[model samples]
Target: MRKFLLPLLFILLFIAESLFVQFLPGDFFGGNRILAPRFLFSALLLLTIFVGRKKGIIYAAIFGLIFDIVYIEIIGIYLFLFPFVAYVISKIMHVLQANIIVAYFVSILGIALLEIGVYEMDYLIHVTNLDFLDFLNLRLYPTLILNAAFLLIFIYPLKRYFEKYAEALRDE
Candidate 1:
């Protein structure tokens, strides 16, 4: 139960966030120049780190798959990329523990770059026609910034929650 609960909770959070993106008022507040979905990806990356590499990879893939399904994008792009990013972050988790703020910022930045790279690759290969720079400026950057800001507010709580849960599992 302990092993499953956290990932389940993360999934719920992902669903809620997706709903907010789809139906919330002011989702793209002040036009599309202000926020993007990059934060969601970043948050997932952070959560995965706390959860451990294998679990993190699983969650990232699940999140990406769900995101891809809901957003009408290519089926496996996020599924492939998100987990890959999580795996990369997991490898660096040790280094990141020195300073979480720096870790989070760097993780988010990496996620942003990964996102852009995937999109660019698709576009270049004619799988997509998205205007790379416009998409980054108008959507990706804003979303990433919002997500990073959210991390600033919630990282400690999330870390504590995971630690307590992991401790409980150990006691079991």
Candidate 2:
């Protein structure tokens, strides 16, 4: 149970993201802005911070592949990007203090990296016709706002849970 708990939480977050999107009104913000929920991504960064990087990268890869299959259907994009983002965040986290505030900012960076990465790929592949400026304004900003607000609300619980679990791992 202990070993599976974190991954279970991540799976729940992944599912919740879809539900969150579904619950939103179709005409949100006059239907101009797209609010992409990156709940799992943010939590993955937090996991990297509080837990070990190896575990983080592993989970990122697995969930990312699952995410790609279930949601993106882009095959290798997220499968490649998720572990890459986790690796980069793990490197950045090496020198930073592990705290909720730092996690917030670090998560912002991860979110930006993932967003741009996916957008650029989609654009290059002709999957998205959105111009860069329009993409930034209409998609990125709203997504950042939505995910940041989510982090602000749930980061504390996430921090506490991951920190305690990490401490347990350390003691083992």
Best by TM-score: 2
Candidate 2 lDDT (Cα, whole model)?
0.91
**What's the TM-score of each model vs. the native?**
0.78, 0.96
Q: Tell how far residue 101 is off in model 2, in angstroms.
A: 1.1
Residues 1-172, model 1: lDDT tens digits: 6678776767767776767666755734665474544545665666666656776687688877987897745788777888888877777776767246766766776667676767676877798666867877876777677777777887777767766775775698
Task: Give the clashing residue pairs of candidate 2, or none.
Answer: none
The TM-score measured for candidate 1 stands at: 0.78
lDDT of 2 by residue, 1-172 (tens): 7988987899899999999999999787667788899999899988888887998899999998999899875799999998999999999988998878888989998998999999999999999999999999999988899899999999999999999999989999
Off by over 4 Å in 1: 25-28, 38-40, 125-130, 169-172
Segments in model 2 whose C-alpha atoms lie over 4 Å from true places: none
lDDT (Cα) of model 1: 0.70
Report the lDDT of model 2 for residue 89.
93
